[model samples]
Target: MHTKKVIIVAQLFISGMMALFMSGVMSVIHMGFTAQWFAQWGPNFLTAWPIAFVASMVVGPIGFAMARIVLRVEDAV
Candidate 1:
């Protein structure tokens, strides 16, 4: 039980960190030093940050939940 909890917690943390990194990458690509170059590519570049951030927010929890489920199944076998 304790091990399961630790695994779940670790998975959640990893998923959150991955989500944050993806969001940050989008932010940097859209608003950082490359902003001018990205703008030249298309207007949609301005919208990528928010989209990636929101997607990450949704994906992280879902990923964590899935990881927990998989861990539980593995423990059962």
Candidate 2:
């Protein structure tokens, strides 16, 4: 099992990367590949990162549990 520190750090890295890419992609899709898209991407990433981090913390355990269940079922079969 991962330590709490490891989990938190992993969440940070995961959330940051996810937020960065998602913000850039959405900004481009909505605003087009222009100066405005570049302008919005940074602020959008800043806004999204924290929310993504919190959401990942909440959802991570549930997802892990579900994966464990699935794996166990496969093992039993």
TM-score leader: 2
Counted clashes in each candidate structure: 0, 0
lDDT tens digits, residue span 1-77, model 2? 77899999999999999999999998888889998788888999999999999999999989988998987744332
Give lDDT: candidate 1, residue 7: 57
- In model 1, the Cα lDDT at residue 68 comes to 82
Runs with alpha carbons beyond 4 Å of true place in candidate 1? 1-44, 73-77
The RMSD (Cα, Å) of candidate 1 is 7.9
Writing each residue's lDDT as its tens digit, candidate 1 over 1-77 gives: 44656755665565556555655566567678575644543444334545655665577558767998987755343
- Residue pairs with clashing backbones, model 2: none
lDDT of 2 at 9: 100
- In candidate 2 the C-alpha lDDT for residue 49 amounts to 100
> What is the lDDT for 46 in model 1?
35
| lDDT (Cα atoms) of all candidates against the true structure | 0.58, 0.92
